[model samples]
Target: MRPEPGFLATYLEPAQAARAVAALRARGQRDVRVAAPAPFPELMAALRAPPSFVGWITFPGALLGLTGGLLLTILTSLTWAEVTGGKPVVSLPPFIVITFELTVLVGSLANLLALVIGARRGLRRGHFAQGGPFTRDRIGIFCAGVDPAVERLLRESGAEEVTRVP
Candidate 1:
């Protein structure tokens, strides 16, 4: 995929910027992001972002952890199979502890894996919006695509200043 090396940030009041973002989304502008001085529920309502997929990753991780744990325990027991205390060759009871430990271990590792994947995606060029001075009580509405229509929309939405970045 070709990366968009340049983007535009339209500075505006916090509330107006959030509303502008929402309006832009409603108009089918997909490559939009907002930066603000602080978090606000109104902004979230405006953005209407879908729920995060972290839970989906976590579920698969748990499944992998459980399977890995069971496999490890079963393999270890099979290799050292012996009748002890008049028990079966593969003692299911003793294996439970190992299986549980491995399950938790693998599950934790999966969470770490998911975090790394998410970070990688975020770091990709044009995947993140560049907001300037967002922490200084100014809100920035960043758009990845630039065109005369987009610029006009920003001006009509009450932007105090509009600038481009690469």
Candidate 2:
């Protein structure tokens, strides 16, 4: 048999969305999702989700970039050593430029790749609360594992409208 339905979506202002998300989590609903016209840092904090998965990729990409930069500097300097001005074979100061550029380049590329993959995983798709004018001018909170009692609680909690979607 098919599993039971999940969240019952509701429209609210940004502030109300934050509260509803918090309340649902308090009531042990972990599968909550919210949609808003713009970024809602407050609601994200309420849900306890991380700021962005891109951040996780950034750190490792930076490390890899730096290592690659250092390796490039070392190999190039050693392979094409020039003793024109009695300078050191491995110039540390000049390598900073390559290191910095590589770090930024790799970090940006990794962030873009992560965002694309995330979108494929439904990060960019609309949630239940994404209907009507809400996608353009309002915020929404969708509480998963909902029942009739939960729906009533949401209605009583200042939801402008509640919708149940299959």
Strongest candidate by lDDT: 2
Q: Which candidate is the best by TM-score?
A: 2
lDDT of 1 by residue, 1-166 (tens): 6766434555646677777787778778887776666777787778887876766787788788778877887787689887678988777787778777877787778788888887576456543345546667677777767676777777788888776655
RMSD of each: 4.0, 3.0
Go through the candidates in order and give the clash count of each: 0, 0
Candidate 1 RMSD to the correct structure: 4.0
TM-score of 2: 0.81
Cand. 2 Cα-lDDT? 0.73
Q: In angstroms, how far off is 125's CA in candidate 2? A: 8.9
